[model samples]
Target: MKSKYKSIIYSIGVLLLTVGVLDKLWWLYICTIYTEFEECRVAYLSLFPERFQNAFLLTVIEILLLAVAAIIFSESKKAIYQKKASKILMIISLILFGWSVFSLM
Candidate 1:
């Protein structure tokens, strides 16, 4: 396939995946607001009394990982475009990850 087409398709796929993930995350938040039955709530609710901090930390990590995966996919070769995309992605991911870890300190 042509590089231009490849880039477009990949971009759309990434965008869709990102949208799905974010929607699921939003649903989790919404569940907290809407649900009354304990069992109908989000997954993290069960851990509240014992592991709220850990759950919160893990959720952040999960979001970061999803972002990183999107970056990697967007940077990967499809045909001919994205020639420097991977390099740029590596730099950005490294910087962002570094900043995130630093913030956690």
Candidate 2:
């Protein structure tokens, strides 16, 4: 793939990953808030399937996929400077992963 195309693909992957991470955080926050209220907790869980209730697992999978995509993007880039973007993505992913883990605990 061309450099421009690679960058675009990388950006899209990053965006998707960002949205996924944010969604996980939002759901976690909502669940935490409703923990004291059993009825509200059940209602909220009912809104999503059983699989989706495990936001931590889903977010971890997303982070792994995003990391792979970033590696591919960096490898495809002709310019060395573009590799820096991958570093930024990695840092963001790590922080999000840590946040998700903390929330789970």
Kindly list the per-residue Cα lDDT of model 2 for residues 1-105, writing each as its tens digit.
565676687776577557756666666677677756665455555666787765456556656665655555455343453567766665665566566556567
Q: How accurate is candidate 1 locally (lDDT)?
A: 0.53
Query: Candidate 2, which segments miss by more than 4 Å at Cα?
Result: 37-60, 69-85, 98-105
Tell me how far candidate 1 lies from the true structure as C-alpha RMSD in angstroms. 8.4
Best by lDDT: 2
All candidates' TM-scores? 0.35, 0.51
Highest TM-score: which candidate? 2
Q: Which pairs clash in model 2?
A: none
